[model samples]
Target chain A: MNDHELDIILKKSLQPDVSVDDTLFNEKEELKNMKPMWIIKPAIALVACAAIVFSVFTFNNNANVTTNNSSQSTDTTNAFALKVKAVGKQVIELKKDVSIASRYGEVGAWGGGENDDNNYETDYYETFPIACEGNNIDKITYSINNGSFQIINVKGDGFVVDGEKVAPLDKGGILPKSCSDRGITNMEDMLAENYEEGYYSSFTVDPDFQESEDVIVNICDNLTVDEETYRKIWCFSVGPYKDKDISKLSKEENIKMLELVKEGMNDVLSNVVINCTVTYRDGTTESKEIGVTKIVVTPEEAKTLEGFKNKKVKVPSLYTAYKAL
Target chain B: MNKVEFEDMIKQYGVDLLRFCRMYLYSKEDGDDLYQDMLLTLWKKRDKIDYDANVKSYALSVAIRIAKNRRRTWSIRSRIAPESSYEQMLDSGTQIKLQDSKAKQSSDPEDIYVNQEQIIMVRNAANELPNKYRAVIYLYYSADLSIKEIASCLKLPENTVKTRLSRGRALLKERLEAMYYE
Candidate 1:
């Protein structure tokens, strides 16, 4: 059918079934009881950092020692110094953990969503303590811009970054398939293009580059496809457009253009990968250069596109955008 | 927030939250657990939430984060019993109920049959979508949230949300045509 009919069917099918029982909120009884105490907990975690650290470490280690037991002594005079040392060590460890967590959190959780994979930060920290076990930490510092992290784990080379032993950047095999697939272009080829002119930029792991090893992924600059090419396909597929310069268009005009693009592109945009090269660790690469004419649109989408073209929408062919690009 | 206010807030947003959980998580059982956990989180942070802030949006944001974290932990569970398709995720009883609901709305026998089948087909297709696309579609269509509201809730650009909705609808349209024509 037409767009209107399609919209009707979708809206009708997706309507919420509001038959939920009122008693659903009754289960909130237990939650309500814990409210005030739970509300104050993050503040507590921030203030009583040492205690929280102690409890967390103790719980994870399954250690039987309490804060009292760790410092209790028959010599009252020495107990004060021993307690001070223990607190100092605990503070050091807490700083190290938090530093590691924050550094990796920025890397791993940066621009990530619920559907996105591999919290690099959480994964790094999960195995951090165990990996660096039996080492005494004197300092833990990291650079924000560069992923270079330094953790003083005395056993030596607990993990290595750039051939030096460090904690944060040493965890291995955290690459996503999108970044790891072979037959793509070489790292340099991916980085050769000026991306500011393009619609989007992507970051992926480049194992072949020996600069950073184990946990880090490299950004490929040349691998980016210009947004105009995709936007053209998207715009044409949504409806029709003139060869008007995108730069000359007003903000409202651009929005209208995007709205049409949305209508035409439908959901097939994710699958619309152009021929690109992927570099392997061995320095060899392959190209998956499927043309835009071969863009994977379903029969229904194709039919709908044709219908729009036949009508006043005057949608252009998907290949027209590809050919122009 | 007072107990009465909390209850009122829940009453207002519970259906939307439950529906979101169901759509996001393939299993009803997992959805139920996530729904409870989300409410617990909102309750804990109730005092911190401003009175003028949009509670529904805030609750949705919390629910999404909780679900994402839980999914990460339960990744193995998903792998072990992969509900790859919505048809597989839906129980026979639920399917029957959906069919009956459609049937009650239509007097013509053929229309009833077609409508039921179409519903099942659409639901399965919707389930197959990538999480991002499915989420946008559910919020827009089922929850009746605007594109702006959805973008705000998911912390995405409005254009991104619009693109996803377009892509999601394309998939749904593809499936509907396949079932109807072929």
Candidate 2:
């Protein structure tokens, strides 16, 4: 087609039906729904804090009773507090010397027209570090929304020893084959995997991979855990894993696994609770339950969250952002 | 601007703004959502708007900003959780129906078919362009905005807008020709 012919075609195709009435745009409804963000933020923060405090107190009380019944020698001290810095940008920090942060890297893209450079858009999937104060930690188990607790174990090679402190293999650690095999580098692949499996592999590390008792308790007495150094050592994997092997499961069992995967993926960071079991050199064991309440985010991430809350940014699915992360 | 003036502005330029949104987003549903959001935002910021200035230009600029922000968010979202095949088929069906309705002026079946094919080709070609080029092309042709107006809305120089339009047209021509041959 000539330039003039192309212009005519372009105009015709690009111009939408302007005569159609907008039934969706109701000013009165929109105005009525628009509450000031300043009012909503404080109310939400207060409610969240109250809920966290109540839940933590109840959990700690139950743990104390259990410890008292089981063994009179056990220490039931609340030593840890799990605070979520941000939801979309998942950052879990311990008061002592451990921090776990999930980051989505734009590895690559696929599927674009020959002439379309803009079509190459990055697909995001989460890779996070698994670090903890290994000296006192006997075992750590995490649960989502008061669900059954699942053990958090080291994956890929083994723990990294920094003088007396030990942390799980950081960012360079190998991820589960299931995650790597799917090649989740683009939108098309991600969607295909989501449809077929009903959910992406929620955890970066193999949850079923159990570490030996020796590895779990390998720590030195003189070494102090550096929270800053551990925080910087980002890992490729960390999250709750399924109890059973997927390959060995029956069809019904497979379905249940899918359900669990979907549930874990959907659960927000706010709902996550971590239970840390500490072991002292004197052979005394202590149980501590950490509850997440306050969300501390950087200024940039805060802006994005605010924009999302204000409805300025449209997220297609409720937990799709989690999938991207 | 008061509510009356806001209502008037919507009455005058709402359709164009909605059309701009649809073109930018490439989805009727999302376009409608953006349009409502734009209207709400405009109403919220009505007092701050210069009453004597080009209200349509201001409205279009707001829509553009919203579209850009939403797309940045949606880009990640769409990649992870794209619409299902059934939903996509439904969207395609809607597009065909829209094309058919628009082509009602043509009596001949062959002419309607040709028109529909041509329209889909042109749209697909345009959609493939980068946002910078597509925005300029859509504003110039779809929204009927001048280069000066587009420059003002985008906060880019008039020369930059002109360059984008020219490059956008060239890319569209190349893609359309390839599609025609295929």
Candidate 3:
């Protein structure tokens, strides 16, 4: 349909019939009868204070235990402790060995245990480390393989890990049947639960390759880091895709295709340039270009990487995936 | 603004504001609640608002801000609790009410059926849009707001509003066509 027809339909569909007069009258009456805020404020404040104190105590205890346990693990240290140095007043240099892994892996059968041989498909993703310090990141603009930087808009109140803001990226995944049965359909809830269950170790954001610019991904916008701890932003999947006629390809050909896809993704990751606009505590803003080291790895090699073993790292963008094709 | 002036303003723009809330929230009950909240907020801040300015635009901006804040709170709450019986009830009830209202719009049974189906399809398409586009589209169409008014309310560039409006229309049309063919 044309724009005018669509506009008419939109107007009809959106403008629902309702008794506005009654609604306004009722609302006005409610407003007139509403209790003064002073009476409720103190009660709410007391309850809020109690809740905050209890939560903080419990959280600190849990955090202490977590810190102790994590400190003992080399893998955790390597994965969580991103290395960076101040290049100048505004720039921070990422170490050359800091790299991202792009992997192509099999998710499962298409229809969940239907077990048809033709249904097996592979997915691709790239996992990288991002760090911010001394300021809140408003947004990150990243260029893949020297392409134009695409802006990822971040939002949310992220958790602090070791004085650094650790925000989860939107690594899109299907809600498990068990969770769905429990009426847990929110992706954030699922991600939080998964993180708690040790299924996810770092923050993830879903990669959008459809648009050339302005790919918005929600994370913690208010995350600020101190001098010491640099938060490691985790893996984001490009989103899942079913292979086209995987049944027709020979086993060797399938393996080759996966390798090719992996290579294409790594190529994008290798030549990445990320710039972040940060809002400092003093209200000053600066856009700093982050330097990254590119270490390309195969799926097998990725498995041997510290803190990455036995974990399912989802792949990133259709752009690289289709490029490989 | 005085009480009489406020009431007059509400009478003039109340339906559109309520419609905007419902479209934004995609729930009749929540929309009503939001509308009430907006009214109460507007009433409380009446002394601070300038009477001669674009009062409608100011009122809408308040509604948008409140709606956004409410949506954010809902997201956080949903993450914590995962589900709420009240929300489910509201959603299902709203769907039924929408269908019933559409059916009552025409006397002819066949026409009513077709109209209801078309309305449902369009609503679904609109609902599926991302918040940015949906807000722009709803403000432009449902609230009868001009592009300049929408930009002011949304705090977006006029060109950005135009782009989102165009994109929202394109997406809506695509979805409607797909539903029709299906």
lDDT of every model, 2 decimals: 0.39, 0.43, 0.43
lDDT of 2 at B52: 74
RMSD of 2: 18.7
lDDT of candidate 2 over B46-114, digit per residue (tens):
889886788877788888876654453343233332334213323433223344645645554433323
Listed in order, each prediction's TM-score against the native is 0.42, 0.45, 0.40
Docking class of 1: incorrect
Q: Judge candidate 1 at residue A180 and give its lDDT.
A: 29
Docking category of candidate 3: incorrect
| Candidate 2 segments whose C-alpha is farther than 4 A from its true place | A32-325, B76-114
How do the residues A1-325 of candidate 1 rate in per-residue lDDT, one tens digit apiece? 4455567666655543434672175454654432111000010110112111111110021211123221222333211100000111121112211111111111111010123521111111111111111112211111112132222211222222222222332211122122223221222212222111111122221122212112222111111223443333223221144335544555456555545443333222233333223333234443232111112222244344321222222121111112111
Model 3, B1-182: lDDT tens digits are 88888888888888788777766666665567677878888887888877777777777888877765445223323222323422432343322223455555555433333355566667668866877788888898767899999988888899999999999899988887888779
TM-score of 1: 0.42
| Worst 10 contiguous positions by lDDT, candidate 1 chain B | B89-98
**Candidate 3, chain A: TM-score against the reference:** 0.27
Q: Rank the candidates by DockQ, best first.
A: 2, 3, 1
lDDT of 2 by residue, A1-325 (tens): 6677667667767776654476236778875554221100011111112111111000000101011111222444424332322233333343432222212111101110111233322111222222323233333333223322211223333322111212321101112223233443222232245311111111111122222221121100111112222111110001121223324555444334333322323232334343444444445655454432222223344345521332221211111121111
List candidate 3 segments past 4 Å from native: A25-325, B76-114
The candidate with the higher TM-score, 1 or 2, is 2
